[model samples]
Target: MSPHPALSEEERARIDYLVPMDHPFDFRPAPEVPRYPETVRRNALSNHPLLRREAARHHQLPPDLVARLAADDDLGVRGLLAQNHPDTPAPHLLRSFLEYTGPERSHLTSRPNFPTEGAGRLRRPRGP
Candidate 1:
């Protein structure tokens, strides 16, 4: 979240109507959200979760941006990298990020990824 007013109240309100999807679930009439200023729209477009997710999928996303997205508050955004993004975070970093999630979110990290033997590790609590 911006500590400064990067978004006006009207622009901020528009963001509430926009939904970032991992995949489309249902179709609906696009809501009539207010338009944002060009600067706001450009900034929003660059950081849009869909864009971020796709960027995170690439091994070439700039390291700084990858690092920034690693700390993104949105779990899905975080998962986009944490779950084997080629330059996927190390096991320790994955633990640090995914630990915030419950079992339901584990599938994202539970792929044949991580430094573990199988996806089974994610479905069960880590052993001591």
Candidate 2:
């Protein structure tokens, strides 16, 4: 039986559309998924981390939602915003890089605006 039995067929379809089947670390959303700004914003504000994560992966995610998700309590939501959303601020990307040890860690470094010069300050000194 499905874990989320209450999910309607449309809800299940939305999940299937957003969640990639392969290249889990890829920044790009599924090309075939239709843009739905209202739905994306709704998901971004969802209390459930999984729903927030899905919203974070959307290519057309609204700027307001991006800002909101950047401050999300769930590391997964923040990390997905940093990884997938082009408009994610550098601060959020840096925070995600520092906090998330996910497979996409390296990719965050390559983002156009990801800060590099002062990154050494973020690391702790080795044992004396």
Runs of candidate 1 exceeding 4 Å displacement:
1-13, 18-47, 91-93, 96-113, 116-128
Q: What are the TM-scores, per candidate, against the unseen true structure? A: 0.44, 0.71
- Regions of candidate 2 where Cα sits further than 4 Å from its true position: 1-26, 120-128
Give the alpha carbon lDDT tens digit for every residue of 1-128 in model 2.
11143664456555633333233434765559676777777677665566777788886776788889889887777888888887778888898888777586888988876888898886669997
For model 2 the local lDDT of residue 11 reads: 60
Q: By TM-score, how accurate is candidate 2?
A: 0.71
